[model samples]
Target: MSNRFKNLIVPVLAVVLGMLVGTIIMLVTGYDAGAAFSALFEGAFGDIYYTGETIRQVTPYILAGLAVGFAFKTGLFNIGVEGQLIVGWLASVWVGVAFDLPKIIHLPLAVLAAAAAGALWAFIPGFLKARFRVHEVIVTIMLNYVALHLSNYLIRTVLSEKSDRTPNIHDTASLKSPFLEGLTDYSRLHWGIVIALICVFIMWFILQKTTLGYELKAVGFNQHASEYAGMNVRKNIILSMVISGAFAGLAGAMEGLGTFGYAPVRGGFTGVGFDGIAVALLGGSAPIGIVLAALLFGSLKVGALNMPLEAGVPNELVDIIIALIVFFVGASYMIRIFIERLSKKKGVK
Candidate 1:
C-alpha cells in the first residue's frame, strides 16, 4: 500500500473493530445490535432535524478539538480547556447582558470577551510552564475547578435573578437565527457552524502558512534547537496556550450565544472540554482531522440518545464504543507494524 493508503488503514480498521466489538457486546447483553445501530442512524441522520442537531453539536466539538489539537502541536497539553471554556462562557454572558449596542458591535464584542477570558485563564499555567518549568497539566487541571466555582459564585451573587443561571443575553448579542432554526425544523442549529468552519481554515492557514506558526512549531519540535536558532521559546509557549484557550473559549461562546443564550451547567464540568481531548487524540492533532473527528464523535453523541429511547440499549454502551475507539487510536503503532510486516511478507513471496 502507498503511504497515503497506510495512513488511513488503521483508522478504518479501528472503526470496523469498534463496531464489531459493539455487536458482540450487544449480543451478549441480549439486545439486537442492528436495531440499536438503526436507531442510532435514525437519530443522527434519518431526517433533516436530526442532521441539524448533529451539525450543531459538531460545531462546538470542532472548536474544542482545535483548541486541544493546537496546543498539542505546540508541545503543550492544555487540559485547562474546560476551565477556559467556563470562564469564557461567563465572560461572554456578562458582556451580553451588560451591553445594549447594535447587533454587529454587540455580537463581536461578546465573542471577543469570551476569547479574552479564555486566553487570560490559560495564561497563568502557560506562564508558569514557561518561566518556572511548572507542569502545565497539573496547573490547568486545578484551574478547571477554580473556573467552575468562580462562575457559579458570580452567578449566584450577582447575575442570577433568583435562579441558578443568569438571564439570557440580549437578542443583539445572540447567535441564534430564527430563519436557520426554522430551516432545520426547529432544531437548535445556528450560524456557529460557520464560525467553526472559519476557525478550521484559519488554524490551517496559520499552521501551514504563517511565520509565527513556523516558529511555534519549531519550538515544539525542539526548544533547545529553536532557542539556538534565536527563536523566543518562552513567548511561543505562552502564545500557544493563549491561542488554544481562545479556541476553547469560542466553543463556550457558541453554547452561550447560540445554544443556550445563557450560562448554565448542571455539574462542575460540561464534559465538552474533556471530550475535546479525545477528539484531538483521535484526530492525530491535525487541523482537518480534528474537524472530521469532531463530526464523528458528534454523530455518536446525538445518536446515543436514541439507542436507549428506541432500541432498548443503554446509552453507556456508546461511551464504551468511544473508549474503545480511543484505545485503538492510541495503539496505532502496533497496527502499523503489523501492516508493514504483511507488506514485507508479500514482497518476499
Candidate 2:
C-alpha cells in the first residue's frame, strides 16, 4: 500500500477503537450507549442550527490546531499557545473597542492586532530558547499562568470601566454576520471560518512550496546539520514560533470578534489551546488532517451537550472517549506495527 494510505489507517483505527471502548464503558456503567451515540449524531448534524454551531466551534479549533501543529512541524513544542491566545484575544478586543474606523480598516486592524500580540507573546520564549538555550516548554508553561493573571489585571484596571469584561466591539470591527446568522437560525457562525480555511492553505503552501519552508523543516529535522548547511537556525526557530503564534492569535480573534463580541476576564484557561495539542497529534501535523481532526473534535464537543438532555448519559463520557482517541493516536507506533504484521501475513499467503 502507498504510504499515504497507510498513514490514514492509524487515525481511522484509533477513532474506531475509541468509540468501541466508549460503548463498552457505557454498557458496563449500565447506560444505553446506542441512545447516547444516536443523540450525539443528532445533536451534531440533525438540525441546521446545530450544524452551524458545530462549524463555529470548528473555526477556532482549526487555527489552534495550526498553531500547535506548525510549531511541532518545525521542531518546537509551543506550550504557550494558551498564553498567546489570551493576549491575542485581549489585543483584538482592545483594538476593536478602542477604535472607530471604517469596517474595511477596523476589522483588519483588530485581527492584525490579535496576530501581532500573539506573535509578540511567543517571541519571548522563542528568543530565550534560541539565545539562552532555555526549554520552550518550561517558559511557555510559566507564561500561561502569567498571561492568565496579567490579562485579568489588565481587564480590571486598564481595559474595563470597573467591569469584569471589555465593552462590545464596534460593529465595524465585528466578524459577526447577519446573513450567516439568519441562514443558520441565528447561530454564531462568522467570517473567521473563511480566514481559518485560508490559513490552512497558506500553511500547506508554505511548508510544501517554499524555500523558507524547506529550511524550516530542515532545521526541525537537524538543527546542527541545518546550521552547517548555511541556514540561520536560530532565526528559523524564532520565525516558526512567531508564525505559530499568529495562528493562535487568530483563534482568539474568532472568539472575541465572532463569538462573544467582547473580551471577558477569564478565570482559567480557555481549553481550546490545550485541545489543539490533541488535534495536532491526531492530524499528524498536516494541514488537511488538522481541519478534519478539528471537525471531529468540534462535533464531539457540540454533540456532547445533548447527552444528558436526550439520553440521560453524562456528557463527560464524551471527554473520556476523546481522551481514549488521543491515547490511541499516541500509540500510533504500535498500530503501524500491527498493520505491518498483517501485511506480512498477507504476503506470505
lDDT of each: 0.91, 0.94
Candidate 2: tens digits of C-alpha lDDT, residues 105-188: 999999999999999999999999999989999999999999889999998899887798999999999999999999999988
Q: What stretches of model 2 exceed 4 Å from their correct place?
A: none
Stretches of candidate 1 off by over 4 Å are: 1-4
Candidate 1 residue-wise lDDT, 1-349, digit = tens: 7887776677767767778888899999999899999999999998889999999999999989999999999899999988898998899999999989999899999999999999999999999999999999999999999999989988888888657899999999999998988998999998989988999998889889999999989999999999999999999999999999999999999999889999874466998999999889878788888888899999999999999889999989988898888888888888888999999999999
Candidate 1 TM-score, true structure as reference: 0.97
Output the TM-score of candidate 2: 0.99
Alpha carbon RMSD to native, model 2:
0.8
Which residue pairs in model 1 clash with each other? none
What local lDDT score does residue 238 receive in model 1, on the 0 to 100 scale? 97
